[model samples]
Target: MHRLVLLAVDVALIVMSTLLAIVLCGPQSPLPAIANIGLYPLITIGVAIPVLWIFGLNRTVWRFTSLNDCWLVLAAAVWIVVFSIAGNFAFDGVQGIPGSLPVMQGLLILCMLVGVRAAMRLRHSVRRRGRMARALFRDERENVLLVGLNPIADLFLRCAAENAREHIHIAGILSNAERHHGRSLRSCKILGPPEAAEEVLHELSVHGIRIDRIVLAMPHAHLSRSAQEALAEIERTGAIRVDQLSAQYGLSELMFDSAARVRVAGSEPSVIAASPLSSGELPASSYLRWKRLIDATTAGIGIVCLVPLMLIIGAIVLLDVGYPLIFWQQRPGALGRPIRVLKFRTMRRARDRSGRNLTDAERVSKVGKLLRRLRLDELPQVYNVLLGHMSLVGPRPLLPVDQPSFSAARLRLRPGLTGWAQINGGRHLSAEDKAALDLWYIRNASFALDMLILLNTAKTVLFGERIDHRAIEEAWRDLRS
Candidate 1:
């Protein structure tokens, strides 16, 4: 899966480089002359993919690509140029295209291939730096999962808990030894064997508990394959970071008292603070990470799938309302940050070229009203989802004036296109009532519940909204409790 995605990205980069080489090599106004540059581009790509693959370009991980790999990249560029020209010669004797176009294209492809890898390496470096930096100043406690249970683990847990400055809560422990199952160390339960890491994570996610990071209790070289796989899976999901507790760490200074004192002078941090669900710094756990990945991927695919429908809607709006095909407004997003929400323009200008103002009914076109009824206007906000402004299911983003008083909690999660409130009572629910239901989602969020809300959304759209007074009351009761 990873290699396939890399191959696709390379192909796209090669195609883009081809176009750029043509434009830069050709005379100005390259559009009119593109017809002359015909089959050569197609022939070039046919030769390039196999040649690049043969050079083993796709085998290297972009994030870890180094100077040692540059020779291979350079060799791939040379072969692409050679075979492309040969393919063109075989196809049509290489007559019409510019003589230097292939060379230019090859060089451009080489630069882009290397440039993208460099960018990936930089992003990886930046994220690591950001985490190290955040740990220094963040007042919120981190939820930690221990990957092994041993004497080393025992000492680390004891020191962390007893240290006055340790702002960490030990969620549980995972041991490779079956003997440690159902055991307890320093009031921390051995959740299960290391192989059940994913299962343990999912169980925590249901109750809004997310492990910020996993610490290997023993040496890296001594860990078992199952322990390694568990860590890799967790890291790959981007859910939690994994670190090893070195002998030097315990010898030099514990993560708590001494380090904390050195990092911040004369300040105290909460020792073993409660779950982050209350701190507003929600852990990027299994569900939150999967939700983001799903939201972005689904929205991106949805935009591609709905492009034709969107174009049709745009045409209707243009024909009826004229210009400015999209309507955008600022709405309060996650944590009250402002974000621009986009939709197809469903209304005409308030007033025409005339001096008189128009009525609200006059502003809305019949086509617009129909779009509202069908909820097609919400389609454009999928791009918002792709952009990280919203999710597929959550609380709706409200205008500043319309937001509920308890919006701070609602905003903990990003506003969604369709939410629990939308599928439940929708517009009929009072502001406070909607807020209560949204709060319920914040506390007990899980992938299963999100899927349920999405399934019900279809029913709500087809057969108007349903009101559940009991559910609303239950939400309020949970919140108060």
Candidate 2:
């Protein structure tokens, strides 16, 4: 039900934004002959919405949406402008469309969409205020003990306080002694350390105060053995339900630009092993619905927009290299099954004297080389995603024969067009680095991480940034050494 409502909001924003863009671009409407331009608004919405998904905008709850999210929307808008201009220049074949129109359209569309979200935020703020005030006025406020104060939970509490809404009034902060006992953080006194959590809870309950949710807001570092043990003890009391703040808001220490240290006594730090075959892990099918929905939507749109370009490329490949313009090869699919992956043939059909195929770098033709460099070759795999054999973002699929130990470990899930490995090291990554990244992704795959990787992929491609091939290889070598 929550997802359905969110999806509805997403579709609404796309349509509203596109219509608003058209209106902001010029007169009440385009000239009758060019009134076909009105359809462009829908087209723009079609493009923008998927781009928003690619950027993982909807992953964020409205209350927690931040400036960084807005930047992503703005960047997606910019991409829409570029893709629109490029598509027009290459094909559209029509004249008299406003030169500045698309850019203006993108800006206005983004502003409107952002405005709608902002308006929701304002409403939320007012409602929270009303609730807080009501709680205070009715003397119905509970002595609320907030456990963690991470950014997201902080924002919610702040909203409540600012509005004076009738809700659980904050009594104090409950955290580890090292973090809050000796320090001043946002006016809330740290009443007791996590080690003293039970004593504190008992004291509150005995004093006729009721404890609600224990909002877990510690950084990833703070989620160490000591913290977990303390939290475990807290949980045993059956006095509070632990609402994990970091996981809910996607707020980790890495998300912050600043650095902070976590002190863990007598514990050795180790990297998460990179492998698809991790034990006791959930099946990738758990997210299959999300994967398929995104794939179908993205690929459907991509194929429509790229049909003309595909036609031209198809012609060039046919004339230059004869038959079989599309290349398909067997690669590992989800759970190590075999699937035929598709790409535009960038290599010739030449074989060795033994009748074996030549290596990729060797058989790769001039046009193919250009296509590979620009990533036009992989355009066809969008279909693979649509067909459910692949995903827009996950661990990049590897050839069955080249299967490294880690892929077998990681192939517990489906392969993706772009993933943690692709963004971090790409073609430059070593098996070990790829494994680590893939495993990390498997452990932490979410709507937002996928979006971040997709955005990063765009940045890498557009700027011609060298994939950190050296770093990847070195990481492998270091592991072996």
CA lDDT, every prediction?
A: 0.77, 0.66
Q: Which ranges in model 1 have alpha carbons more than 4 Å from their true place?
A: 1-16, 20-285
RMSD of each: 19.4, 15.0
Tens digit of per-residue lDDT, candidate 1, span 21-103:
88888875778545677677787678667656645678897777889777778767766776677667767786667877877
Top-scoring candidate (TM-score): 1
* Weakest 10 consecutive residues of candidate 1 by summed lDDT: 264-273
> Which lDDT tens digits does candidate 2 get at residues 236-260?
7676667766677676554332344
The local lDDT score (0 to 100) that residue 42 gets in candidate 1 is 84
What number of clashing residue pairs does each candidate have, in the order they appear?
0, 17
